[model samples]
Target: MERILEPELMDDEQHALAYAQADFVEVNRGFVDRFRTTFPDLTRSRVVDLGCGPADVPVRLARLLPALGVTAVDASAAMVRLAREAVQRAGLGASIRLVRARLPALPFASSTFDAVIANSLLHHLAEPGVFWHEVQRLGRPRAGVLVMDLCRPASPSHARDLVETYAGGESPLLKRDFYNSLRAAFTPAEVARQLARQLPQLTCRVVSDRHWVVSGRLP
Candidate 1:
C-alpha cells in the first residue's frame, strides 16, 4: 500500500483531547508490560518516551519503577499540555519530564538517556530514518530501546475491518486518523530492513495482529 501521510503533529486542542480521551488504556498497559517483561534487567535511572501522546505509558512506567525518571517528548503542543495535566493528576510530576519537541529533531545531546522508548510513533513519520538515528544518537551506550507501533494492513478492506473492530466508538475525526495511521504503518519485515541499515542492534517483530514491536539494547 502506498503511504499516505497524515498531519504529523496532533497540535489542536479538541483533536488532541479526542486522542487523549480515547480508550487506549489496555494498549498502553500492554506496551509497558511488554517493555518490563522483555527487558527485565532494565535498571536505568533515566528513560525517554518519544511521542508520548497522553502520558499513559510514562505514568504507568514511572509508578512501576518509582526510582526511574522519564523524559516524555512529543511534537504536539496540545499533547504535551494534556500530558502535563495527566502527569500531575497521577502525582508523577517529579518523575516524568514533558518536552515539546518534534521527532528526528530532538534537542538533546548524544547518549543523554539511559533508555529510549516510543509507542505508535513511527507510522506518523515520513523519514523513519530520522527516528532510528535519534534513537542511537540520544541513547547511552547499550541503552535499552523499546518501540511499538501499528502494522499496515495487507488491504483496504482489512484496514477498515481493524478500524471497525478497534475504533468503533471513537469520534469520526479520530477514527479517520486511526485508519490513516494503519495505512501509513509499515510491516515488521520492512522495519527490520530499516533497522539493519541504521540500527542493527535493534530487532523488529510482529507482536500482535495490529502491531509490530522493535526492541533491543544499543550496541
Candidate 2:
C-alpha cells in the first residue's frame, strides 16, 4: 500500500479515462473474449474486478454472464461513484457492487470469490508483491485471477510519442495523463518475472497487441 500509487489521485484519472476509452470496444471485448476462452469451465462464477474504473468490466461481465455476480472495486472514490452509477443505469444494480478500496489490501475474506481480475492496474503499483499476496489471500484455494497490463514499451520515448499523437489536442492535462499511463506500463517479461517470484502458483501470459494476462488456480 505504501509503495503503490495513490488510488485517490489515480481514481480521478480513471473517471476521465472512461470517456477517453469510451469507444474502445475492441479493447474491452478483447479481454472478455480471452477470459471466456481461457476458462470455458466457468459458467457463472463470482467475480471480483480490481481497478474497475467506471465499472465497465463488471457491467460487461454481468451482461455476458447473466448468472454471475460481479463485485467491482477501485481505489478512487470518484471512479467507484461512476462505476455505481453506470451499473445502476444498466439496470444491473443487483448484479454488481462498486466499492472504493485499494488493491493489495482487499476487504473481502479468503475464498470469497471464484475468480479475480485486474486490468491495467499492476504497473501503477510500486509494490506488486503486496498486490500478489493480498489477491492470493482473497482468492479461493483453486480459483483463478486474471490480470491485464500494458506491455512495457521497447522505447520509452517512442511510447511517449505514440501517446501524444493519439492524444489529439485534448489538453495538457489529458496529454500528461496518457503519457503517465504509458510510463507506468510493464513489459510482459517483467510482469512474468515479478509474478513468478511472488505468485509462483499463477501462470502469466501475453495476449494480442498490448495486453498481458496472468491467471491460474492458486495452490
Candidate 3:
C-alpha cells in the first residue's frame, strides 16, 4: 500500500484529547522497556523524547531511571499541556521538562542530547529524511537512538483489521486516527532505506505485526 500522509501535528483539541485519553499503557511501557533493553549501558544523564504524546513514556523512563533527566518535545500544544499534567500528576516535574516545538527545527543546539528517542512519530512526516537528519543533529556522537512507529500493512484491509484487533475498544476518534496512522506508516524496508541514507548506523526491524523499530547508536 502506498503511504498516505496524515496531518503532521495533532494540534486539534478534540484530536489531541482523544489521543491522550486513549489507553496506550502496554504499548508505551513496551517502548520504554525496549529502549532500556536495547541500550542497557545508557549511563548518560541527558535524554530527549521527540513527539512525546502525553509524556507517559517519559514519566515511565524517569521512574525507571531516576538519575536521568528527560526533555519531552511535542508540536501540539494540547499534547504538551496533557503531558505537563501527566508529569505533574506523576510527581516528576523536576525530572521531566516538557517543550512545545515542531520537528526538523528543534530549538536545541547540535549534539545537545546524549540520547534521542521517539515513538510513533515518523509516519507523520512528509519528508522523513529531514526528521532523521534532525535526530542525527541533536544527538552527540555514539548517542543511543530508538525510534518506533507503525508499519504500513500490505493493504488497506489489513490496516482496518489491525485497527479492529488492537484498538477496537478505543473511541471513534482514536480508532480513526489509528487507521490513518497505519495508512501513513512506512514499511520496514522503506524505513531501512531511509536510515541507510541518513542514519546508516541504525538498524531497522519489524518488531511486531504493526510496528517497526530503528535502533542503534550514532557514529
Candidate 4:
C-alpha cells in the first residue's frame, strides 16, 4: 500500500490533549522505569527524544538524569510550545531544550546523541521505515533507541488483553484513541523486519510485551 506523506491529523486534537494531561502520570510510569533500569550508566550524556509530544519523557529524563543534557524534538508546533511550558513549569528551563522538527528529517547532524527515545509516536507514522532510517542517521554506534508503542495482538486473547488494559477506565475518546493505536502499532516481528531492512547494523529487540528498545554500534 502506498503511504500517505502525512498520516491523518490526530482525530480530536483537543481531546487528545486533554487525555494526555489526565493520563500522563499512569502512561509514563512504565516507560520511565524501563528507561531508568535500562540505561543506568548514562551521565552527562547527550540524549535526544524525537516526537516528544508534551515533552513529558524529556522532562522526566532531565529529572532522572540530571547530569544528562537533553534535547526534545517534536513535529507539532503546539506540542513543542506546550513542551517548553512544561519544562519551565518543572523549573528545568536551564536543562531541557525543545525543538520543532519533523521526524522524517531530524535537525541534527549524524552521530549527535548518545541515546534517542521515541514514546508512543511510532504508530502515528505512515512510514516507520523512513523514521527508522532517520533515527539511525542521527545516532552514534553506541546510541540507544528506546521506543514504546502498543503491541500488535496475534490472537483473540491478546487482542482482548490489550483492550482491557489500555481501554479500561478511560474516557470514550481515550478508549477510542487506545484502540486506534493498537491497530496502528507494529508487532515485535514487524519491528525486527523493518530494522533489518532499514537499520541492519543496529541490534534491535522487543524488550517488553509492548516496548521495543533498539540499540547497537555502527559498523
Candidate 5:
C-alpha cells in the first residue's frame, strides 16, 4: 500500500491527551527490553530518545539502568508537557531530562550521545532520510541505536484489522490515530533502503506483525 502521511506532530490538545492516556504498556516495555538486550554493555551511557511522547520509555529505561542519564525530546508542546508531568510523577526528574525540539534539527552537538533511541517516530517524518542522517550525526562512533515503529500493512484492510486486534478497546480518537499511523508507517524493505543510503551500518527487520525495527551501532 502506498503511504499516506499523517500530521508530523500530534500537537492538537485533544489528540495529544488521548494519545498520552492510551495504553502502550506492553509494547513500550518490549522496546526497552529489546534495547537492553541489544546493547548489553551500555549500562551507564548517555541516551537520547527522539519523539519521546509522554516519556514512558525514558522512565522505564532509567529505572532499569539507574546509572544512565536519559534526554527525551518531542516536538509537540502538548507531548512535552505530558512527558514532564510523567517524569515528575515518577520522581525521575533528575535522571530524565525533557527537551522540546524537532528531529533533523536537535540542539545537541555531533557525537554527543552514547546511544540514540526512538519509538514510533520514523513514520511521522515526511523526509525520513533526514531523520536517519540526524541520528547518524548525533551519535558518537560506535554508539548504540535502536528505532522501532509500525510496519505498513500490505493493504488497507490489513490496517483496519490490526486496529481492531490491538486497539479495539481504545477510545475513538485513539483508534482513529492508530489507524492513521498504520497507514503512515513504512515497510521493513523501505527502511532498509533508507538506512543503506544514510546509515549503512544499521540493520532493519520486521519484529512483529505490525512493527519493524532498525538496530545496530554507528560506524
Candidate 6:
C-alpha cells in the first residue's frame, strides 16, 4: 500500500494537549529500557532526540542516566511549551535541553552528537530520506542511532483492530489520530527497502508486534 502523509508537527493546542495528557508510560519506559540495554556503558553521553513529543522519552532517559545530556528537539511550539513543563516537573531541567527545531534541518553542526534517537517519528515524514540523511549528517562517527516507528498493518481492518486493542482507553479524538497514524506508517518491507536504497549502513528490524526499530552505528 502507498504511504499516507500526516501532519508533521503536533503544533495544534488541542492536539498537543491530548498528546501530553495521554498516558504513554509503557511505551516510553520500554524505549528507555531498550536504549539502556542497547547502549550499555553510555554514561555522560550527549544524545539528541528528534521529534520529542512533550519530552516523554527524553525525560525518562535523563532519569535513567543522570550524567547523560539530552537535546530534545521538536518542531511544534505547543509541544515545546508542554515539554518544558514536563522537564521542569521531572526536575531534569539541567540534563534535558529542549529545542524547537524541525527534522532533516537541525540547527546543530554536522557530526555533533554521540547518539541520535527518534521514536515513532518516521511516518510523519513525506520524504523519509531527509530524516535518514540528517541522522548521518548530525551523528558523529560511530554514533549510535535508533529510529523506531509503528508498522503499517497489512490491512485497514488490522489497523482498526490495533486501535481498539491497544488504545481502547484513549479518547475518540486520540484514537482517530492513532488510526490515521497507523495508515500513514510504513510497513516493514517498505522500511527495509528504504534502508537498502537510502541508508544501507543502518539496520532495520521489527522490534515488537506493531513497531519497527532501525538501529546501528553511524558509518
Each prediction's RMSD over C-alphas, in Å, is 1.1, 3.4, 0.8, 3.3, 0.6, 1.0
* Tens digits of per-residue lDDT for model 2, 82-139: 7777887899988887778876667898889888887777777877777777778877
Residue-wise C-alpha lDDT for candidate 3, range 32-69, written one tens digit per residue: 99878988888556999999988989999999888889
Compute each candidate's TM-score over C-alphas.
0.97, 0.86, 0.98, 0.84, 0.99, 0.97
Number of clashing residue pairs in every model? 0, 2, 0, 3, 0, 0
What is the Cα-based lDDT of residue 141 in candidate 4?
75
TM-score of 5: 0.99
Against the true structure, candidate 6 reaches a TM-score of 0.97
Question: Which tens-of-lDDT digit does each residue in 121-209 have in candidate 1?
Answer: 99888889989999999999988999999989989889999999999999998898889999989888889999989999888888788
- Is candidate 2 or 3 superior in lDDT? 3
Ranking by TM-score: 5, 3, 6, 1, 2, 4
What lDDT does each candidate get? 0.90, 0.73, 0.92, 0.71, 0.94, 0.89
* Candidate 4 lDDT tens digits, 47-144: 88877878888888888878888889877766776778889899998778888888776778999988877787777888788878777788777676
lDDT order of candidates, top first: 5, 3, 1, 6, 2, 4
Stretches of candidate 1 off by over 4 Å are none
What's the lDDT for candidate 4?
0.71
TM-score of 4: 0.84
The candidate, 1 or 5, that scores higher on lDDT is 5
Q: Pick the candidate with the highest lDDT.
A: 5
Off by over 4 Å in 3: none
